[model samples]
Target: MKLSSPENQAETAVTSSLQAFLETDIAPKANRLDTDTIALQRALSQLNQFQFLGLRVPKVYGGLEASLLTFRQVQALIPRYSGAFAFLQTQHQSAASLLANSENQVLKERYLPAMAKGETLMGVGFSQLRRTHNPPLTAIPVEGGYQLAGKVPWITGYGYFQYFIIGATLPDGKALYGVVPLIPTPQPEGGNLEFSSPMQLSVMNATNTVAATVENWFLSEEEVLFIKPANAIHDSDKKNVLHHGFYALGCARAGLDILENNAGKKELPFLEESHQTLAQKHQSLSEAMFAALPPTETSFQYRLSLRVKAIHLAQRCAHAAVISSSGAANAQSHPAQRVYREALLFSVSGQTKAVMEASLNTIADYV
Candidate 1:
């Protein structure tokens, strides 16, 4: 991969833009939100207007064509304002990234442009618990293309998204992925689809993760796109995992920013000494963690592990910030409330803390 000189500058620009949005749009509405439904949709629309939704698409498709590193930096910024918005943006980019590997020239030309324009949203359909989330090779030949029958749980942006990239099993049990356009057409007697309320979440209340079921859904051959080897797709998936890892970075930064901005206010005579000690400890710890990441394959795992650790650390920072703020900081009206909620959400992304720990251990063992 070619490292570009503009990557850092791009990251800085994205961060600054997101911070501005958070301060102006998202923060004011966090408390006044109507039903969570209205709040989430509104946030998404605002982000789309800023073209944050197409951060990963190629410039040819009207995207910023940002490097993976740049995208990670942007991801970190989203949670600083709204974790839900960040989560949604991640889903959109993930789908767009998958489209990069697509073979259907027509599909790519059609959808990629629309995605860049923010006229459409894309999501993944690969959360079958029993099976690994590799691409599907299933070619259950049907009249149009194939009958894609499979149960996918935990679709992040279901119901609201227009395009969903689905994974399924070929008759031979190999995995293949299909890009299905989820248009809101007429339904059957009961319903062709069932939408659920947001799963009660510990954090990231704005990200509406919902379970979905698709029965023998018909997909045109164009929808099948390129059913390439799963290993070919793994490389991109790894990049995405790392990029998503930046969410923790943003959360931790937000927590630390809040803490530092109010440090003097936190200085009581008794706690002043402890406050200085905590600040130094966190600073050194963070520096060491950041330094441990060298730009190598091994560093990928290290960075990922650190991101998970950072999520927990950020939560600690938030706790400290609230405590240092003398309890009034925990009020729902305070920005810290939203930041704290996002900190919790950052800790429990689609892959939970335990799962991430296992992945880290696996990566270390492999190395």
Candidate 2:
């Protein structure tokens, strides 16, 4: 939990590095990134060249090991240029963060160093465990390690990641996290990893999100990342409740950028005023969200409220951009249109029941 440096200085360094990369490389190609697999792949690689992929890994593991605020700053800045890259990179960063906390030295050594440099890439598939129902994925103890069987309803980065960390419930009411192949691979015991065609999502479909059936797949000890109590995600969610809001904040900025540009082009006084009003609101929300990051500083309920506010602002800002742009914004590739769609995705990116409720209430207030 130690920060890398003073907050302001760290923020500047991270923001400048990411902004330079995004403006120079991603902005010109933003419109095509939504469905261009090659463009997404190249973007992912180029991010690695700048060591962005390793932002969360420990410094000892050769990562930039940025402060949490700095890391979240990157999250907010990225979607301003390309939502697909923002969405895709977050998956890998999540995997790297999980691995960095592992008690399994062997697994840490195998992945952390390479992950820090983007020499290795991975994804995560465990959100299904959030549902309180018959487990969609389960693991049973075996001679060598554990046997995992069932379905992973959502696994992104199919063609982009070589391996991914899958989470499944254990009979003892614990959660088992282990590395599994991202590609299709048959097991010896009439078992296999089979994936459906990449889903055509409303946004970031280029990340190749797909469901998988893991039938009798054996997860060896060497590949095991860690095991935690069943409530781990719920607890983690409480602690990191504000984490995903930064993406929405970034998306809001994207909308404002479009709105400001259009205002200048059209010389509309009202549009300019609208941009300033919305920009100030976004700034206020941004500051409040950052100030509330310390777990002890705010109640979970308040943090949840801030998170929902961020979600609503993103939607509102994007909606404003759409309204200001007139007919041309209807183009399938319009930046405003894309940012609007991204707003929808970020609204529920890491939604829990409380988050879901809070977000709906915010929308209802607008209605």
Candidate 3:
């Protein structure tokens, strides 16, 4: 319950508690929750009560400000039980990250404590790729503050969250961050927030993705948070490095766990060597990703460069795990199959394989 202290003992305690909860409460019912919204809600409510949702919020707002390393450890462990559940939990932490970075005190005070206590849920709308094919969607300014009128293709956790952080373009065409409430709307099918399922592919089937529209959605002066300075992609990239680092680490650890469990149960040649090599590669990549993200340090585009390398390493590890799993992994019911599928989700963390590849190529050109 102590906040702001980086203690190994606390982390160990949290890990043990979470593992016990997953085993007793989550594992037995994970299958049911995978496609059941109500079950997911019940589990998430448990997570909230345990303060898992507020693990990274600052102590002043009733959060523990848990160390990033501890956060990563928890994320890794959660996927061992269920990747779907783990991702839902991570979204809360991501919300905490947004709260931590925002410059608006009023917004922080109003939402952070409630979010920490799990009385409210938070979602972010920043994944827009403009229909016009702009660099990214921008927030244009309007009367008083700004009007956010764009489409974010994949806003996760749509119906469940009560608040959202939106990115928009100002009138001068400056990119800005804004916050809005997702409540008190007109009646819709018995008054619940309407949600549409995203087109499903492989991993994270139950994440509840939806396309969000904020058409001329106006924000008052109080709701506008920080407008990132131009040419701050370095800082942006650095932050994303940390975020995606944890994500990749979580998926890799899940994959490694599957690999370790299935090791020596087969007659595959060089199995030990394969496992060891993959483990080493994953570890090195994880370290590199962590090393690239220095807390509070801002630079232009360095984060993006590091992210490209880190994701490539993660893809390699995921591929290796699947190939090594071979005949045993072919079954969709197999844990290895699940891990393999989940691993592919890492490549789309920002949602465009083409852009990701292009960015990596651009970085490589300079290197």
Ranking 1 against 2 by TM-score, winner: 2
Write the residue-wise lDDT of candidate 2 on 1-367 in tens digits. 9655574565477668779989989998988889999999998998766677888888788887877777777888898998999999899999999998889899888898999888889999999888657989999999989999999999989899989999999997789999999999998777699999999989888989999999999999989989998899899998889999999999999999999999999999999999999999999999998888654488888888889888999999999999999998899889899999999999989889889988887778875
Q: lDDT tens digits, residues 1-367, model 3?
A: 8655456676677778888999899866655555566788788889865677788788889886777767766765686567678777677677778877788899889988988899888877665522224534456555676555555566667557777776664545456767765543433322222334564757566667676555456577798777765435334543454465456566676666556655667656576677788788777766665555446475435555555655565556666667777786787666666666666676566534433765468547863
lDDT: worst 10-residue window of model 2: 2-11
Model 1 lDDT per residue over 1-367, tens place:
9674675676567667877888888756654432276677777777665567777777788777776555655665666655666676678888888786677788888888788777888888664422444422234766867775545666676555787787776665455677765543333422243445657765555556775556556667877765554343444444444444567666666666666667666455644654565556556655555454335345446556665566566676677667666677867766666677776666656564444675566547753
TM-score, each model?
A: 0.77, 0.96, 0.78
State the C-alpha lDDT per candidate.
Answer: 0.63, 0.89, 0.66
By TM-score rank, best first, the candidates go: 2, 3, 1
Score residue 129 of candidate 2 by CA lDDT.
80
Candidate 2 achieves a global lDDT of 0.89
Regions more than 4 Å wrong, model 3? 1-8, 19-34, 129-143, 182-197, 231-234, 267-269, 291-310, 324-328, 351-355, 358-367
Off-target runs (Cα >4 Å) in candidate 2 are: 1-14
Per-residue lDDT of 298 in model 3: 51
Tell me model 3's lDDT, rounded to 2 decimals. 0.66
